[model samples]
Target: MRRLLVLLLALLVATPAAAQVRTGIDVLQQNGFAQLRAVAARHGGKLKLAVLANPISVNREGRRTIDVLRTEGQAAVPGMAVVKLFSGEHGINALTDDMDIDDKVDAASGLAITSLYGRTDAEKRPSAAQLAGLDAVVIDLQDAGVRYWTFQTLTKYFLQACAANGVEVIILDRPNPLGGLAVQGPVSTPGREDYTNAHSEPMRPGMTMGELATMFNAEDRIGAKLTVVRTTGWKRADWYDQTGLLWINPSPNLRSITQATAYAGTALLEGTNVNIKGPGEAPFLRFGAPWIKGTELAAYLNARGIAGVRFLPVTYVPANDKLYPFAGQRVQGVEVLLLDRDRIDAPALGVEAVAALWKLYGATFQIEKVDRLLRNRAVLDQIKAGVDPKRIAAGWQADLNRFKARRARYLLY
Candidate 1:
């Protein structure tokens, strides 16, 4: 009996505990959505709400936030109703490949889906008519924790529109998959603000959606009635995988945590002529072009001795002819293999990768287009001029320090 007891204790000690990180939706559901109800109560006990969500917006049990708000939320919170659904960069389904999303009706929820993403900048936010009847807009989208990701921009736009109108905004925060530590890369230069570079933050701002909304509200002086239902049991240092949540691809190409980590660097390639969308199940984890010499490129990247990552030669014919460059033709490139997530400076790795490609394939490499996502013309110029990538990265330190200090004032976690 003593020996059996000792074995049981040992087994228990070896096993890890279940993840305790509870997202904002989980907390809201736990509290029967009192926060939402209070907002509705202020506006004559009738809430006409709109939700900006994607497939990733789910509760702990994987119930979609829209469904919960429509069913449980209505039941729990008197006079609260979800009137409309808003889609960000990707459509509500999150499967749309096209940048310009059209307004449609959600098949499952039977709600009118408004596409916040469109060809023109004016179409990206809710119009005065759309905001007229709405009491509050609930934002519950997952973010990639990088500045270039368009969802954060959509959130900022939503907040601006809501503030302009009288509607309140409630942010049901989720984890910044990359974690809340490690601010990296250059801050967006003034007057370089586009849809992709919405805020002046680093390439990887390392902030959650709720925190970003807070910063945007104050810094931009929008002064919207903003409420952030923050996640519980989440540490600033804990990555999304550490949160024990289901790994839903925030975007189609960003399939896994590893891929998302690689995306911070590899995604910069997309703006250039290089194809980061892969030869494998994972996109952004690898990049290639028909002109690339796989072994030579890999050798060059490996020679740089960039910390926390390595490169491997790969050759593949992209499956989709329409979507990827050199679709049917064979393409060779290097796959970025992350060795240490914590130690890797993804933005720096991106700089090095672009520099390598420029040196090897300068004639064909469209290095100028890289600034679209990189948001730094000086760095792009430096890469073109053959400046050491590490040295170029080091130059951004002062700017990063200033941004870090500004960012510190807005961090919730």
Candidate 2:
């Protein structure tokens, strides 16, 4: 009897947890809870459902969808329940750094909100007990279709943890604000991996966070049972406005579509000496390093006639803040005008702007340092070597093609 008991214990220990559960966007949009309710009913055990943190707008508009699931879980699933809510960098109650957000909890929902960023950023899995009564976990976060955003990082960590704990994760995907096609930029190198940039890719690969996640799993072989609930009728090239979907501020800094459009390339300026503060405007568009000869750089860019854009030179002083102590410091730079909105390529534009400056003022220009900011040396190196911008842009075509081919298999839309 002792020998038999020992063998039984070994067998139990070796047994694997159940395969991960999976769901798609269709289920989320149409009737996700029905499936969860059914799973809980069948398990006849406690079921825990968690709504991961998201950008303010996603949480606000998508709250109704989440509430529906919560309501259904309580009403139908026996021994099933919804517990704590998790948020990322901005926190669950919409608290943000510098930008003030009202972190008020819902009086009716009574869901205890917690900050994943506060407690831990890279860690996404709750305790096994947290999943004790739960059969699976569901994720519904919005993405802005660019690299360097934290929402996708939050998702990746969750998937990794769930896999380790034998928990399944469902990703309710949304449209890529930029579109599905056109993978720009070089793949991220191994050493460059960090929180803001989970992958080592060149600036602006023109991929949605969902697509990036799928690519990351495949390349890294995460081995998690992942499924993306993609947006319907979304073409690879269509921008967000074309979809006519609701618009909500993904982050405080990203106030309007124009800002989002400009951010892809200009945001890189933040990593540099550039200020990105608007020229004495309430939501200043973007300010660059005070040292940059804004007027000269603007003229060079204007001469290039890079399709669909214009730069304006003006002096800027931050309002109510000493961020730039050189307030009233006269700087020459232009307001960017999208001559052809459809033709603007953010990453390319950024590189060209940098290149133009380097060309005009070789010694005065700083190229090598900014290369790190771009996350790859190729874009800057090519320009320094006097490679034509058009040709340099062409060199990336093959890599982009390969990425597109591999990316096709994972296209949920």
| Per-prediction TM-score | 0.95, 0.78
Local error of candidate 1 at residue 227 (angstroms): 0.6
The whole-model lDDT of each prediction reads 0.88, 0.60
- Against the true structure, candidate 2 reaches a TM-score of 0.78
lDDT of 1 by residue, 1-413 (tens): 99999999999999866459989999999998989888988998889899999999999899999999999999988898999999987688787667778889988889999888888888886899888789999999998989999998898888888999999999999989999999999788878888998888899998999999998899889999999999998888888888989998776688889998988887888856677884344688888898999999999999999999999999877766466676677789988999999999999998899999999999999988888899888888889999999999999999999999999999998
Q: Give the Å error, residue 110, model 2.
A: 2.8
Tens digits of per-residue lDDT for model 2, 249-341:
666566666777676666555534445553234232445445667787788788877766888766555443444433555444456776675
Worst 10 residues of 2 by lDDT: 17-26
Superposed Cα RMSD, model 2: 15.8
For candidate 1, the per-residue lDDT at 101 reads 80
